[model samples]
Structure formats: structure tokens, C-alpha cells
Target chain A: MKKTKIILGIGALAIASFFMVAADHIDAPAVASGTADITDFYAFQAEDPNNVVFVANVQGLLSPSATASAAFDENVLIEFNIDTTGDNVEDLVLQAIPRDGRMYFFGPTIPGSVGVDSAIETNATQTSVAISAYGEAATATTNAGMKFFAGPRDDPFFMDFAQYGEIIAGNATGFNSPGVDTFKGTNVMSIVVEVPKTMVGGSGTINTWVEAKTKQ
Target chain B: MNNIKTILGAILISAFAFNCSSDDDSNNNEGSMSIEPDFSGTYTQQDQMGRPAVNTVFVSAASKNTFNVTTPDAQGAAFQPMFQANLEGLSPAFANPGDMNALMQTSADFTGLLATDVLNLSLDGETTFFNPATGALLTGRNLTDDVITIELLLIFGGEDFTENSQLSNDNVDANDKPFSASFPYLASAW
Candidate 1:
């Protein structure tokens, strides 16, 4: 028991260190440069207005030509954390994982457990959709009022990162009129989930975030 | 929206014909997958984020591991000072010569505000990164929020929000492609 506990602790720490190395776009340590890296997280009111959508984009900085064969890693799970009480603790979690050309989704329901660790919530309300292949028509699946999609999409984040770097380095004062889009023509593998507001604890204020976890 | 959905529906219908074997039995009956995912052990967090550029801008490379592992609840206490120092260092407009931005929050308070690093959303109101119409801040993010620009302005713009105009906007105004008008609204991959 003691040995097992120590091994688990070391494994958790190792995963934590690996997690720190991935944030937005290129510049991540080489080990995390692939699918494990998350580029952005966006949560907004869906067009239905009664539903909310959460998008967690990963593996950013892929050129158009390279995006053709890019795919989601089967081992990683992307989880969206929702905190309804403002305590910064997640009350509910919605997770997505890809397998055999489909992205499986589980839960906008209260997590049976929470924290740095997570279980697949295989028992929670679940859904799945075909993983939209690059250059193919997109595919989305709707189940039990929740919608799911996982696939590659044009990288939506636009930035003049080069100029911003210059400004931070004290070489430039401001950006030019039409700032160069450093991410132009790049793509990211995006996982999007839209759920009814009521399903996510409904009608007040909430704090949200995203994390990528690998299956142990 | 209708056109994309129609296209998607057709593709799904055709794809399902060829790949129906992949569907897990869980759809008709929950927890009944013949092959269950390996969820037995704890999967530790590798990375977390609530807002754009928070970790990349505030955390020095040396502190990336420490910063990434800490939870939002503990982030403020653990890294607020580091954020403040970095903010002041990167933006001279926020340091000795220029006053802090319009919020007038002290360095500690400012960093404290950002340290938690989770996006705040109000369910009852319009979801947006910031509502310029009402002057509200950080409610939720939109596809075209120009978040980096907003972050720069808040950190270096000072009391008038005009202290460092040059450093305020990044010049990239919108995504290269227009977002979809329906479910799963991200633009198509190039």
C-alpha cells in the first residue's frame, strides 16, 4: 500500500509538471507540443440564447496543409469545469474524449468527484458525435438536449504576437493600423459542447475554465 | 447556419452508414458500454486556464510548473506578487512613470483580480468578454473580443485609458474566417 501510494504521488506530480508546459500556441516545451497543448477556451451564449457553448481548442499553430491529417489523441480528455457558487471549485464538469473516429462526451452534471484528478464519468448522461475530418463537411450530434462536436477548425484567435513581443521588449510603442495576423492560416483541433443553461446550474453567475487530462 | 447544418447532416448520415459499429451501447442504456474507458486511476491535471494570456504573460518560464499546477482558488495567494512584478516590468506604463489603469486597483489588488484566472459569466445578462455598451468587464468571452488588446489596455493604459495608446491594441481585429451562425460556431479549418 505504501509503495503504491508513493508511486501514485510521483505520477500525479509528473502529470502536473507536464500540464504546466502547455498553454496557448507554439513555444510550449517540445514534450507537450502535440495534442496535449491547449490553445484557448471560450464560453459564450449560444445562438439559441437558452443554451451556452464551451469550446476548448488544442494543438494550435498547425498550418493549413498540415491540418489535413491532424487528429485528436485518443488518450487525452478535455474537461470543462463549471463553478456555480464562486468559490473557484467545480460543481459540474463536462468532458470529451475521442475514440474510433467519434468524440464521446459525458456530463454537464455534478461531478461525482472533482479536483486535479478526474474519472471519465462514464455513468453520467453521455453522447457522441463523429469526429469531423479535416476538409470534410462538419458533423455535430445532438442528444438529450446537449450538442457535441470535436474536429479541426480554423484557429479563431487573432493576434499581432510579433508586434506585442516588440512592445513588451520596448522596441515598439504601438501596433500598426492593420495588425498582421500572426495566426493567419493556422488551425486547431476544437471540441465544442452546447448545453442548456438549466443543465449547468442555471440563471445567475458562474465561473468556468478548461483542463486537459490524460487517461491513467 | 441552415446550409452548414444541411451539409453536416448529410455527411453524418453517410458516415453513420459506414461506421455504426463504433457507437457505444451507452447511448441507449447508460453505463452499458461493453468496453469501458480506463477511468480507474486518477488523471492529474496537466494544464488549466480561465482567461487568455494569463499564464503565458504573467508566469515566467521558471515558474511555469508551479503556476500551472496551482488551482484557481490557490492561485491568488501563490502567484499574485509574481504577476504584479511581471506586469510592472513588461509595461513601463504600469510601473514608475504611469499611473495604474482606470480601475485604480493597487498592484496587489490588480494582480489578485487576475490571479484566480477563471472566466466569469453572468447567466442573466448578455455573455461577452466585456460589454463596451455598458462598460462592464470580463463577463464572458466572445469570438472577436480582442482579449489580448483588452488585457494590454487594462495593464498599461493608466487612469485615462490613453496613457499608452501604442501598446493598447494588437492590430489584429478579427479571426481570418467568420464564425458559424449555428451550433459549434467555430470557423471551418483552412
Candidate 2:
């Protein structure tokens, strides 16, 4: 048991070092460019005022050439957690997973269990969409008042990392009038789900987060 | 809203019927065959995010993994002090006692909110990330939202949007590509 504990301590130290190199658009060195690396999460009011869209972008900084071969790992499940009670615990979860070139979705329903571990809400309302290819027209599907799409898209989070480094290093005072975008030409695997307001119950407000969980 | 519900109800019924028939159809276009997904095992959390750069900026390197796994409800109490210390060290806007940002939040209050690391989205109002015009703060995030700039402004812009002029904004004002106008609104991959 002491040996096991030491091994775990070493592992934790290694991860801590990895975090020094990680940034918003990237992650720890262990899973830096892996499919489970979540880059960004966005929840916005849809064009239809009654609907809200949640997007989770992963595998950041893919080049145009690299994007063609980039694919969602079948083993990773992207879960969107919604908390309506202002308690920060997830009251409802929407899960998406890839299988056989298509993306399958479950929930916006109450989860069987919550927190770091998850079981796919297989019994919830299910929907599927053909995962779009790199250079093809986007594919989307709607079912049970929710729309789903999954595939590659431009990394929308903009940053001037080089300049940021300069500022952090005390070499620069502030940002330039028109700083260069460090993530201008990169790509990310994105999963988007738009659900009606009626489905996600809250008093017009909710706390939401996204997590990438790999099958254990 | 009622009309939309009526239309959606009709669509839902049709979709249910179509799904029932497609379940038996062998030639469904989605894939080779329709099968219930086997979600029998546990999935361990690997990475998590809510607000765009909160985790990247606030959580210390040694605590990144710990913060990622810690539930949001528990995060503020666990990390707020660390976040406040970091903010006071990094940003001159919070350099002194009782210094506040444009939001009128002291370093402690600001860091307290940032420590939780979850997006607070408004379901009924305009969704945006700190819109200057309408004062819509954290209702949600839009694809085209200049989130980094807003975050920078809050961190360094100081009271009345005039402190630390050099550190106020990133100057990368918009997304590299235009977002789509329809559902699944992200721009095409480059």
C-alpha cells in the first residue's frame, strides 16, 4: 500500500509539472493534443430566443492539414452539466459520444449519478447526427426539440499568447492596438447541442460546465 | 411561445414515429445499423471547463488537476484564497487594499466568483460575455464575443475603465472567421 501511494504521488507531481505548460487552448502534457482535451465551452442564447445552445470544443490547435484526419475518440464522452438550483451541482446533463462515424446524444434529463464519474444516460431521449468531415457541408439533426452536430470547426477562442507571455514576463506594459491572433488558423473538434428553454428548467438562469470523460 | 410549443409538439410526434420505423430499417443513413449504445461502464473525468480562461489563468500549475476534478460547488471555498493572492500579485488593478474593478468588485469578491469556474448563463435574457453596451455580464458567451478582452479588462482595466491602460485589452477584437448564422454556429474548420 505504501508503494502504491508513492506511485500515486509521483504521478500527481508529473501532472503538476505538465500544467505549467498548459494553457486555455491546450491542456496538460499527458493529454495535450488528445481527443479528450477540452479547449473551450460556450453557452449562448440561440437565434431562436426560446432555445439555448451549448458548445464544447476539444482537441485544440489542429492545423488545416491535421484536421482532415482528426476524429472524435469513441472512448471519450463529452458531458454538459446544467445546474438550475444555483447550487453548482449538475441537475441535468447532456452527453455526446462518437460511434461508427456518427455522434450519439443523450439527455438534458436528470443524470443517474453525478460528479467526476458518469454513466451515459442511455435511457434518456436519444439523437444522432452524422459527424461532418473536414471539408464537407456541415451535418445537423434535430430530435425531441434538441438539435445536435459534431465535427471539426475553427477554434473560436482568440488569444495573443506570445504577447501574453511578454506581459507575464514584465517585458511589455499592455497589449498592442491590434495584436496578432495566436490561434488564427487552428481547428478543434466541436460538439454543439441546442435545446429549448422549456427542456432546461431554471428561473431563467443556470450554472453550466462541460467535462470530457474517458471510458474506464 | 405557445405557438412554438404546438409546432414542436407536432414535430416531436412525427420524429418519434420516424425513429420507431428507422429503428427497424437496416438501411438508415446515420450508420450501418441502429443499435442501442453500450454505456455499461464508468467514465472517469479527464478534463473540464466552463468559462473560457478561468482555469487557465487562476488555478496554479500544481493545482490544475485537482481543480479540474473538484466539483464547482466546492471550488470557491477551496481555491478563492489562492485566486485572490494570484490576482493581487499579477494585476496592478488589485494592487492595493480595497481596489476594485469596473464591476465594483474587490479583489476578494472578483476572485471568489472566478474561483468557481462555471458559466452563469441567463436562459431568458440576452446572452453575452460582458457586453459593454447593454451591461450584460456573463449571461452566456457568444462565439464572436471578445471574451479575452473582457476578462483582461476586468482583471486590469480597474475602476472606471481607466487603470492599467496598457493591460486592458488583447486588441484581437473578433474571431478569425465569421460565425455561422444558423444552428451549430461555429465557422467552418480551416
Candidate 3:
């Protein structure tokens, strides 16, 4: 009963990233409903069309023993906001930050400027990797092109809360189409990253969002 | 400063003496067990009571691990935004929207096994969040607007990719199972 750390943005101007569910767990009065707090965000175009991919999820019903020592809140700074020509503002910028466990990527390059206030191009170049250790498998693979993973999986989200609670108790008739999946047997706590679509845009239509910046 | 105010007054009485009253249960019984809140809906591969299980898969991956999962294009993504948040004072039957939430939530999630099918995986270790009213064990420390779900297991493609692990390998496949996983997608927490 002492919460006070929410700062989600949209048209207002932190823009991009405000929950794109693949995983969602909110209620009990919308417990910090930061854009519904996404559990999945993926962008495509990379078999070498240049390269692009981004995943963002924040503490959404985590388990597997609290995602086995959950890490990556080093003040939180996982911004992968890019909006090209759609007038969403952000032209091209890719940022990822995680201290010790190693996950420090930044930009596709050009960023002396790009909507709002994002100054950390660090010379329009930066990359640091090493955050895949929790059930191990990727002991050093995708670097430069980018790669990083934080623990705990499963919870890819599936629902049917008792017939969606009998269609909000109207008795029924609305859901049941693909219903009944009361979180199978839940779990959450994943923060993965894989990029290479020539960075994030060198293809067709574009408009992306993923943010969780907390360092005041 | 007076020995730092006597070690911050003994760490605030040892953080309220870390509670130890033999405890009883009483989340107030708001929703009694809470199950309906609204998060939109869509999930195949049944079996919780309604039957039908397996052959409901949706996989998406560009995973290399450095973080860049394309964005949208999952298939137009018209609206994948599920919403509903209300737990009234947090616990004790909660009472409000159609009332009946005493809070005892648990949505564990995690076990994207691989490393050799985690040696015929089979481990369902449990730790699915806790709060039976005021027992409190919420993840992310003191969980508030709590509601979370995620289960996306995409073992391997292109020949199980021989060997290339990095989930902080304890030798990979650290079994804590619910078994039956065949990649693609599975994000839970409705």
C-alpha cells in the first residue's frame, strides 16, 4: 500500500512502449497498470534484410522461484523506441542497459537527435553483451548484432478465467470461442533481446515501442 | 549521529521483527478466490475442464538474446491490448467490481527447456506468487497492481541447434516442470 513509481508515456511524450501483451497480469485495482505492463514485444525483418528484433517484458507474474534471482533493474533503462516517417517522432534509436550481467547496446548509429530527449548515442556506437545465465544454453553467441536474456520463462499468457467469469456474469454468450486457459500453471520473469534487422529499420513499414526507464 | 541513531533504531525494530505470530489466514475474502477481471481472451490447446488439448501453437522468434524482437507484425496486431485492474485495497475479499476476491493468486511461469529436452523434463517446482490476504510474498518485491503471465517456449528450430546455451546455464534445462512444451508461444496470466 505504498506505491509511487509509475511514469508511462504516450502522445504525452515518453511515447512508445506501454504494454503489447503476450503476457499480462493486472487487476486488484489495476496494480500499477503501466500500459498494462507488457510481457512480450517483438519486431521482425531479419534473415538479413539488415536485421531487427526487440523483446520487452517487465515483472509480469513471475515465478519459477521468482525467475530464479531475477536481475536487470539496474535502475531500469531498456528503451528500444523507433518511429520512422509515420510522424511518431523517433527516427531511429536502439538502447538497452543492464550493468553487471552485461546488456548495454545502443543505436543503429545516427542519433545526434531524435524526438524528445535521448542523448546517449555514445558516439553513435555501443554494444556489450553477457546476460544469458539461468538455465544456460547461450554461453556466448550473438554479439554486435546483439543478444541478451534475463531469467524465468513460461507465462506466454493464455486465458479462460472460468469462462471469462461467465462473460462478466451476464450469464454467458460472448467468450468461449478460444476460452478456458486459466494460466495453465503460470510463471513469468523473462527479458530477452535479439536484434539484427540491419539494426532496426532498413525494410518496409515501421512504428515501434518498448520502454521502462527508471533512474529519475 | 548518535551511532547513526542506534543503527537506525535497530533497523526499524528489525523491520517489524520480520513478523512471527504463528499466523492465520484472512485476506478478508473479498472475491473469495478471484478469477474474473477482464484481459480480453484467446487461447487454444485446452484441458482445464473444457477439454481439447494440444495443437494450439503460435510461435514467434528472432531470438539471438541481445534484444530486438522486431515489433508488431505478428499479423496486423489490430488490438492485443488486454486491460482490467482492480483489487480494492489489495486484499481481504477485495470487494468492488462484481465482488468476490480474497486474493490467493499464483501465476508461476518459466521453463523454456532445451539443453537436450532438459533430460526428459518433469519438474513442477512451485512458487506461484502468494498473498492469501496478507501472507505476502509478491514478486518484484511487495507487488502492488499485481497480475502477471508469460510462457513462450520455442525449444529449437533447424535441427535443435546442437549446442548454444545462455539462460545462465546451470547446465541449461534446470527442470521445474509442467512438461509438455513444443515451442511457438504460451504467455499466461489471465
> Highest lDDT among the candidates is held by which one?
2
Candidate 1 C-alpha lDDT tens digits along A109-203: 78878788788888899898999989988899999998888999999898888676666566876888889887779889999998999988789
2 or 3, greater by DockQ: 2
Off by over 4 Å in 2: A1-23, B1-36
- Each model's lDDT: 0.80, 0.86, 0.36
List candidate 1 stretches off by more than 4 Å. Answer: A1-23, A26-32, B1-40
Worst 10 residues of 2 chain B by lDDT: B29-38
Q: State the displacement of the C-alpha of residue A192, model 1, in Å, after optimal TM-score superposition.
A: 0.6
All candidates in order of TM-score, best leading: 2, 1, 3
Mark the 10 consecutive residues where model 3 chain A has the least summed lDDT: A13-22
lDDT of 1 by residue, B94-144 (tens): 787435677786666778899898988777768887766788677788887
Stretches off by above 4 angstroms in model 3 are A1-37, A40-55, A58-94, A97-147, A150-155, A158-162, A169-179, A182-190, A193-216, B1-136, B139-190
Ranking of all predicted structures according to lDDT, beginning with the best and ending with the worst: 2, 1, 3
| TM-score list, all predictions | 0.84, 0.86, 0.25
TM-score of chain B of each: 0.78, 0.81, 0.14
Model 1 chain A poorest ten-residue lDDT run: A18-27
**lDDT string, candidate 3, A87-193, tens digits:** 44456666666666666666656556543334456555566666655455433335575655544456544444444344334565444433345544445544555
